[model samples]
Target: MAAIKPKHQRLVLALIALAAILAAGALATWALRNQASYFYVPSEIVANPPDLDRAVRLGGMVEMGSIEMEADGVTIRFVVGDGTARVPVRFKGLAPSLFVEGSGVVAEGKLAKDGTFIADNLLARHDENYVPRELQDMTEHQKDAVISETVGAK
Candidate 1:
């Protein structure tokens, strides 16, 4: 057999390394496929419902007058809407203080056969310009006074 030149040997080794890295990446993606959750708005979910067994994230505004606590007290049911569509959701556990009617929310869970989303986690969404009630309700002079006080204290 003919001996490979030093340059040729290095080229082969580089190719092998690249092939190994690609294989590892493919394996990792396959293993984590189930862990990767996809996000969808209410309209999208209504148009194309996801597999009942696959985990997904549903994001929309909590419809007003749709929130209801079950008899068990812990289980809550609500309808999430995006103006174009609405999805019924059921969750069990304490919700965040920001989880209120007409507020944006993202619920992570799987869809049930009955078309209800079974949320395992709930995340409240706030606007970029969100401010505390005190700050929002305060006059310009009052806000300046509070800011100065905070700075002086520091």
Candidate 2:
């Protein structure tokens, strides 16, 4: 049998290499398909909810007067709204220090069959003007002094 010419051999090897790379990418995608966490606002979740078991992120402002702590002291429920719709969320464990009524929050978890979001984790969103607790009550002059001192300004 005649051996393959150098040109044909290179082409065959290149095709094989391309096929292998594609297969690896396809496998990676398949393995991580269910690991993706989709983000949704309250209105989006209310309009087209995700599957009960699928992990997702819900982001919105915590509705005023919607927070309820369970008797267990560990479970807290709150409503998140985007002005158009609201989603009830149930979270077990201490919430982030910044989480509060009327504050922006992003909850990561799955939806329950009863239409509640079971949050495994919560992230509190702060505004760009966020100030530390210590500096919150400081006057502008005091804040400037503190900043200058901390920054070693003369």
The C-alpha TM-scores of every prediction are: 0.62, 0.61
Worst ten in a row by lDDT for model 1: 145-154
Name model 1 segments beyond 4 Å from true: 1-37, 131-154
| Whole-model lDDT per candidate | 0.81, 0.81
Model 1 scores a TM of 0.62
Cα lDDT of candidate 1 equals 0.81
Model 1: residue 114 alpha-carbon error in angstroms: 1.3
Model 2 error, position 75 (Å): 0.1
Predicted structure with the largest lDDT when compared to the true one:
1
lDDT of 2 by residue, 1-154 (tens): 1465877888999999999999999988976774443888887888899988888999877887899999999999999877778899999988999898856788999999899999999999754345676764666567444433432321
- How large is the C-alpha RMSD of every model relative to the true structure? 10.3, 10.0
The alpha-carbon lDDT assigned to residue 88 of candidate 1 equals 98
TM-score of 2: 0.61
